[model samples]
Target: MEVSYREEGVASAASSVAGRLVADGVPARLAGGDPTLWGEDAEAEAAVRLGWLTLPRSSRELLPALGELAARTRAAGLTNVVLAGMGGSSLAAEIICATGDVPLTVLDTTDPGQVRRALTDRLESTVVVVASKSGSTVETDCHLRIYQRLFADAGLDPAGRVVVVTDPGSPLEQLAADGGHELVLAPPDVGGRYSALSAFGLVPAALAGADVAGLLDEAAEVLPLLSLDTGNPGLDLGAALGGAALAGRDKLLLEDQLSPIFGLPDWIEQLVAESTGKQGRGILPVVGADPNRSGDELVVAIESDVGDVRVDGPLGAQFLVWEYATAVAGLLLEVDPFDQPQVAESKENTTALLALPDLPTGAPAFTDGPVEVYGAATAKDLPGLFAELLHAIPGDGYLAIMAYLDRLAAFDAPVPEGADFEQMTDAWMMADPLTLRTLLALRTDRPVTFGWGPRFLHSTGQYHKGGPQNGVFLQITGVVTEDVAVPGRPYSLGRLQLAQALGDLAALETRGRPAVRLHLTDRAAGVARLLAAAQEA
Candidate 1:
């Protein structure tokens, strides 16, 4: 838990940004921007509302309250913990669970099979925690309704089993209060992405028996070290990277030495993309990617803790540091750090898609076996098709590989002999996608990024739909060979997976993104083909 702090490269790199913030009156003005310091203001109201500045102080309350709820779960003998939230709400806890001894299952995907699997297997012994800032996130709400019915069918009172984390006056709080579910109020000012240190993350961490107080202590150590005038580590970093982006080094390439904590990169992606990406200006986050080939990128190498993820050391400190850095980056870029104007476009489109009386048949404009193409039609022509897509990217453009598939850590099913590595590569590609991303970024002149389905929808989904139009989306979809059935539901998990995919596609196309849908029959082979095509291009 004692994470070593390497101040060598980071300190030098961050100096310029810190200097610029001072010159721009950024440090002094940030006080005006933060609601914690000056109440609500028109300029940075939304950004300031999210829990960045106040988290250290608020953690004192969150730790004890979350501990009490978690203790309740333990007293009730609830061993299985399932968290239902998307993007920022779930990412930090995902990392914590992965790094610590906590066994918290995150249900962030809309992949029906996974959802059914999570809810059906251990309903009697599980405690379902719904974390959402607005208390009205579409996925969280949809999931809560299903779980509510599942609990009802199991003859268990859903009220006693469910817990919620949201702002005081949000619908989520009302639901928890009215239904008798455990209600944990996140700081009213904190937004979704910035709520990691707030109840949104702590409740789950505490449920998993993580050291909530220790984490706050670690954060406390770093909080005072982040002031702009003092040239502290966090401020130095915030200015360095944020200033670089404003000067056209906009692709923030993140290389991960942080294993078992792969969540860090994704966490940073949401922080950077959602916060700084806006108004035709943004930092395109490249996570777990070592393009090893750099072009207009500011490479950030993260050397994570050598031991298990714990709050005793720099692990907890890192979050506060990055959060502060992101806010400062926003200040330097002259953009509101907290507001997400474009994130709503995709949500509205998804709602519209989900509401249609009859879903449209997703017939392809181009066909190739199980690999049907909506635009690029033939297998032999795929490499060129992809190359053309890559070629079309502007100097400032970026590439996003959006895959819809099961991202299991290990494949239990049998595979073709000598295909285990390839199959595993296929699976890991969906989860991390760093190897493939590095390959693509190296081959092209643009920054490359990747994420699993429904998962990224909650993270980079907003930037993809709302940020600069300078993005090319390569959406990968495949048929689920196996399916998990949701009892009493008309459709199986396989059907639901396709529904979410189609809905997202509709959302993307409606937004005018230059995107392509590649259909594959076999998940492994298809992903392999996509990789081959990207490299060939």
Candidate 2:
């Protein structure tokens, strides 16, 4: 594809950024608690900064081991692999398989429907890759417990079928050790978002039949170009983006007009959002969004050289390219690209919420009505309130739907599994957001985003609270009629889910963000009704 800036003055800035890359005299200073870049010293920032500098070499070093494991997986006759993770731990593997060439399904969402689907999938032969850098991510841990129970109930040995990816001493590392699960330790310096080239992404790629060696080689081949003082593709990209964002084009629309691996933008969105989305400024990377491109937007298209784009080049190489570019943008923005100060607030709030004895007992901030009517009230109720919120967006602002509803849990309401599962549910539950993105983009000259709660809390939540204050958030919460109890935790899945939703609302309110919360009577049906009403409206 093509990569160009829609804003002016970026070319000169690219040169300046290239110069800064060399002149800083700290090309590799990040790994050693260097603070000259951001002029701050925090343990978290210092420890996580070196991944991009050394991950390429680490990947090259680990090639043989990865290949061996790939052979073992093939011998095991695994036809499909399912990855259970969140945000950084999951996004890279997603890109590795986004072309649909990789026989993999990434279970990154906590939607019960998605989890149940994973539970019922080809468990007899499917390989399970449990990836998480933090080792103790709430979602990953809970998912592991769920799968562990399932494996036990089915008389299957999870350790023989599972692999663990994490740092050397993280909780998952210990879990793998305690359970005899295959383990791949990521380089300790690498942050989750930067761990793609590390075993995190490589193992999955190797298992998926991608040339892991070629990917690393391609990544190494680009090092010379990326380190250059001028005309470096990756460095220049950083300059263009950083320069443009500083010039008020902060909404980066990352498009691949001709790539089969179109989901590359999803990974990039997290990289850009989490890295630079702090200090009251950040790049809002748009993935799969192609409507109402505004004047304040910068479009960066990643396409193939000639025909329709596929993952022809080493994906590992592209990962480094984007990492370098995003780091450069962070430098230009004067924000620490390594630390997420706001992400912890949601987690802490969720934890506090989990300790509670019951769900929030107060009335919802707003409710349309009892969601009993199937066609009229069931549909019109949500859309009516949504329209009010949509109309209230500030000038040059975007609309964000923070859906805290149990997307798949409630929908599992005794419906015939095969006769209507595919037809009854929106394809992948994506229609609601895609439809809203289309409608909201038309209704207002601004972008529209749909974030499933708690999941996005780890991905884009930092941007919502700590980045630019230009979002009009609409929250959808529902009664969790059915719930799954975390095996050991004091609370149930329904409680954890609602805590995350309410915790997010608290975080938003803590930031004084403009928001509206609607408590729905039914989780899955409410979303369907909302979409239907929007269509009719």
Candidate 3:
């Protein structure tokens, strides 16, 4: 693994921070699994969270079992692998499978169309891997129940079709045991964001025919270098990230210029944003973000070639090193990286909204074509609404486009038979949210970030609420053409998705952050009108 910073200011700041860390013996202490680095308040959580520090070595024990499971599933003719998980549980697997060039369907949203898409196709040869770190995540639980119901409805035994990965005593374990499903327990000491090397990440990837053993080997080669004071990429990268954030360049614009590992930036977004974006300070990661040479942003290229700050390595080593770097960044920021204090607020709000006799319907400022615009009470048209959202951005702040619609449907075209999902997703034509993101970035100098609804609720949600109050949010929701039920749950997937959007909006509003919601009465037509208006504006 190699980490380099070419900019003189960044190099100077990083060197200063690194020199301080060397004097404090931080590199060796972190490698030795010392939990007191974050001080007394964080010691308890850090003690357990530091397990990731040794995961490159200790996780070798899981290979044989994961290999056997993969072999058995393949022998049973289950070629279609779907991972139903959320946040850390799902992001790592998504990246691993994508990088390994394997086909793995990832279900990380409550969008009904997406759920229906996963269910209707490849039913006979499918194997669903249910992963949840705490086993109590509402989205994961909803997916599990829906899958079980659908499988039974199709005359398939749910027991043989479902496999679970979670902590030992989590509720999912008991549920898995009750249903006679195979259970893989992750390390109790490792937190979800830090479980990339544990069973949570490896199980689904392995089942989908990824190079699991090779990943472990790559990570092992990088392990010994992390403990040394000199030539430690993890320490150097951490210092650079922490120092840059402290220097008012907290908005990280990450580009995958030539990285072979697909979806790596998304994984880094979750790890860094959630780990350090707390206590009124943190790094805000913008994946696939445009270059903003402005004083407020830092561009890091995740490529094998070049950048101001470049990180290049094998996939496995990349995972370990980034995790180490995040932990180190957290120490520099004086925040507990392991704890996501504000993440549960939206969840709690969603539950309350769902329990209501009817979901709360707020009054919209105006209706333009098929879209209902809310917030900025003065806006009367789509262009006016777009202008209002742009006008809300603070000088040093950013604009976040949060789409609660189906990500696949937004960015992807229909794939031809035998065509790859990645290829379809990268097709020439762009969709509503992507077009809006591009237009908005072109319209402003501030950093712009686009996130899929409930997924970002897990990734950057913490940062939006807990980190800085300078964010201006634009949330988009649409009508669900065909809503899917969550079996035992009262709310449908469509309702849960809206509730999540509303809940997140409520959180941001409570924080006094400038936010607006554009409701699409007709998903296709509404987005078209909005984008056209944006173009005209």
Candidate 4:
């Protein structure tokens, strides 16, 4: 792995941090799994979470089992591998599969339409891999219940088609064992985000035909350098990241277009944001973001030459290095990288909202075409509502668009029979939330970030609630045309999704952040109007 700090300020700051770390014997202590780095309160969590430090070597034991599972499923004609997970459980595997060009369907959202699509799409030949660090993850639980029901409805034994990956003693483990399903026990000490090298990440990726062994090997090669004071890619990158943030460059603009690994920034975004975002201070990662747009931003490119700092390596090494770097950054940021305290706020709020008589959308401030604009704004149209939202941005703050709708909402149109994968993907993006995000970005000089709902709830939702308070939020939610029921739960998937959005909106408002909610009464028309309004804005 190679990490270069080019700018004079960043280089000097990083060099100083490296020297201090060396004097303090940080590299050796960290390599040895010492847990006192983040101070007294975080020591216990740090001790348990440091399992990731050894994953590069220790995770090799699971390769044979993972390979066997893949082969067994393939032999049984289960060619469609669908992963039901969220945040760390899904992001790592998603990136790994995408990088390897493997076909792994990720069910990381609670959107009713999305869930229904996964349920009906090639169900006969599908194997569902349910992953969660803790067995009680609501989203994963919903996925398990729905998939099991679908499998049973199709006369296929859910036990034979379902695979579980979780901590040994988690509730899901017992359920999987009781149901006679294959279960892979993850290290109890490893946290979800840090489990990229653990069973949680490898299971789905390996099943989808990614080179799990090669990933571990790549990570292992870079492991030795992490213990060195100088010439250590992890330490250098961490120092640069932490130092830059401390020097008022708290907004991290990540560029990964030139990296061999695809979708790396999304994984890194979750890692860095959730790891450091707490106590009202943290780094906010903007993926595929532009440069020189703001003074408080630092550009870090992974295996890309066009950035203030460039970190280059194989995909496996990249994961391990970034994990190490985030830990080092936590020390500099004076926060525990292992714990996401504020991540539960939205979850708790969602639960509360679900228990209410109805999904409390509270009242729309006004109607804007097919969009129901909510929050404290008098705007009665899309453009006016958008203008008000933009005007809410603070001088050094950013704009975050949280979409509670299906990420595939724009891909409802059928593609031509002969359309290639890339072309189909392009067409999808053109009509997706990304198009609206691009238009909004052009309207603002400040950083603009877009995140898919419940998915980001597990990712950047931490930063949105616990990080800097200067953020202005624009939340978009759509009406569910075909709501899917959660077997044992009273609320449907659409209700759960809406509750999540409302819960997160409440969380942001409780933090005194400016937020606006645009509810889509008609998904297609609302999206078109939003896109057109943003273009005009």
lDDT, each prediction: 0.70, 0.70, 0.88, 0.89
lDDT per residue (tens digit) for residues 239-332 in model 3:
9999888888888888886889898889899999999889899999987667768887877888744456989899999999999999999999
Tens-place lDDT digits, model 2, residues 1-537? 113443345556555665766688534443223556665554446555666666666678777887788788889887578787888877777777765466677777655655667778887777788888879888888888888888888998888788898888888988999999999888888788877787888776677776667667767777666655554556667777887787777877666777655478778878888888887899887665664656666667665432111223346667877887777788889888888899999889888887777756464433444443211122235666556667767665667877765444544444445756676554544335335556556566677777767667776788888898878787766666556666776776667777887788788877666666666576555655666666655
The 10-residue segment with the lowest total lDDT in model 2: 371-380
> What are the root-mean-square deviations of the candidates from the true structure over C-alphas?
4.7, 4.8, 2.3, 1.7
Instruction: Flag clash pairs in model 2.
Output: 1-303, 1-304
lDDT of 1 by residue, 1-537 (tens): 222223333334456666656775656455334433222432457554645666866778766667778788889888788999988889988776766767888888766656766876678888888998888876677678888888897899988788888888989988898999988887777777777788887888889887777777878877765554763556656766765665666787765664444467778888888887777777888776654444466766566433111112355777787877787777667677777777776566555654666555467766544467774333345677677667767777888988776555224344556776778566565433234566677777677788888788766776777667788887777776666555454555555556666777776677576778777776566656666666777
Between candidates 1 and 2, name the one with more favorable TM-score: 2
What's the true lDDT of residue 247 in model 3?
A: 87
Q: Which 10-residue span in candidate 1 carries the lowest summed lDDT?
A: 304-313
lDDT of 1: 0.70
- Best candidate, TM-score: 4
lDDT of 4 by residue, 462-483 (tens): 9887788889999999998899
What candidate 4 gets wrong by more than 4 Å, as runs, is 414-427
Candidate 2 Cα deviation (angstroms), residue 228: 0.4
At residue 205, what lDDT does model 1 achieve? 81
- What lDDT does candidate 2 reach at residue 42? 41
Cα deviation of 362 in candidate 4 (Å)?
Answer: 2.0
Worst 10-residue lDDT window, candidate 4: 287-296
